[model samples]
Target: MSRAFTFPGQGSQAVGMGRELAEAFAPAREVFQEIDDALEQKLSKLMWEGPQEDLTLTENAQPAIMAVSLAVVRTLEAQGGFKLADKAAFVAGHSLGEYSALAAAGSFTIADTARLLKKRGQAMQRAVPVGQGAMAVLLGLEFDAASEIAKEAAQGEVCEAANDNGGGQVVISGAKAAVERAIEIAKTKGAKRSMLLPVSAPFHCALMKPAAEEMAEALSQVDLKAPAIPLVANVTASRVADPATIRDLLVRQVTGMVRWRESVLYMEAQGVTSYLEIGAGKALAGMIKRIADKEAAIASVGTPADVETILKTL
Candidate 1:
């Protein structure tokens, strides 16, 4: 079956995420060490022994998640004799996980990916002052319906659909008041439930314009290469391999809706019959299952044991 390697995003992070992999594989330890050196911090320490609040900070969580994903990839290659180009047809990720996917596919080096995500997280967090912006999830609603609710709730204040996560889930983000209004509107419009998310800032919306611009500056300076495999980008929900276009898309992704549902559908249409979520959590796998209606094989590979299982399959 045609396969895709997917990466998890910010929310997938948890304390002690990579401890098992690091303990079980030398390559995994090296990958974590490299990321720590690149970021000039003992990020692994915070990851394995965290005051949950500190680790949950956007800057820490973004790079920490990428580190775990790359650690898994490295362990797979070094110990299991697997190469992404030969084993997967495409690579994709959710939001920040897009950087992890690119890193796995060789579009960016592990060190560069770490620095870029550090900048991205910091930029996103700084885009809108805390308490001024917010995000909410609307359940049992389709993208089109969610978009209408965002528009109606905006009342000229920037409410926008942020993530079309499929499985009857759509996340909205914008100015706090507008987002609050959208939640209420969504509830009135037959949504199963609508609740504000506990995020530091409203991400993936126009309020993130400043973050997008910052990312443009940060990305332009990086040496990005075309992935060995094409990337199913979040902004467009389509495959992209050109370095210039991918760079542009990464910048736009800061403020653009994460078209996750469409991205999965596009991959399925292109003959992807299996999806491997190579990261800290099974969030993407869960989403893929819902998007594809369990017609495709889905696996989450984070621990060494998980790696061995996938290696046998490969």
Candidate 2:
């Protein structure tokens, strides 16, 4: 089957995610070491033995998830197993996981990605004061309906759709009052459930303009090369590879809706029948099923056992 490699974003992280893979492969261990050297922090320790709140911090979670994803990529390429360039038609990532997809496709060095994500996390957190911004999930509503709720709730504030996750799940982000208003608006419009998300910032809304500016400067400093395969950008929901275009989109993504549903649909139209989620959790896999054909195959690769099992099938 034609396949794509995908990466998970925040909220997929958990303690002990990459520990087994690190133990199973020297290459996997090296991925963590490279990130540690780049950041000069014991992030792996935090990931392996987390005090959940600390590990869940944006600064830590961003790079930490990318590290585990790269570790899995390294392990799969070992023992003459599946080659990402040969086996995948495209690669995609959700939110911060986009960095992981680029690293997997050779767009950025592991160390550089790690450093960038750390800065990205810090910048995103600094963009708005805590509790001033918020995100909410409006279940049982299509993206268009959720977007309308965001617009109506803005009240001259900054509410906007952040992630159109499909499966009747769309996330809204913006000013706290605006987000709270969106919840009421969603309920009034007959949403099955409307609840606030526990995210630190209102990601992917006009309010994130400041964070987008920070990413613009950070991305300019980094050297991004063409990927081994085309990447379906989260913002555009289509394939892109030109380094300049990719850089521009990365900045836009900070303030653009993650068009996840359209992204999966685009991949399926491009003949990607299998989506391999290359990191911490099954979130992306579930979304793909919701967005595309339910029969579309899906898998995850983080531990040694996953690597071995997938290799056998490949």
Candidate number achieving the greatest lDDT relative to the actual structure: 1
Root-mean-square deviation (CA) per prediction: 0.8, 0.9
Candidate 1: list runs displaced more than 4 Å. none
Cα displacement (angstroms), candidate 1, residue 277, comes to 0.5
Q: Tens-digit lDDT track for model 1 on 1-314? A: 99999999878888898999999999999999999999999999999999889899999999999999999999888876768898899999999999999999999999999999999989999989889999999999999999999999999999999999999999999999999999888888999999999899999999899999999998999999999999999999999999999999998999999999999999999999999999898988988888984779999999888998989888
What lDDT tens digits, residue by residue, belong to model 2 across residues 1-314? 98999999999889997999888899999999999999999999999999889989999999999999999998888855556898899999999999999999999999999999999999999999999999999999999999999999999999999999999999999999999999998988989999998789888888888889999999999999999999999999999999999999999999999999999999999988998999888888888888889788888877788888888866
lDDT of the structure predicted as candidate 1:
0.93
lDDT of each: 0.93, 0.92
- C-alpha displacement of 45 in model 2, angstroms? 0.5
Clashes (backbone N, CA, C under 3 Å), per candidate, total 0, 0
Clashes of 2: 0
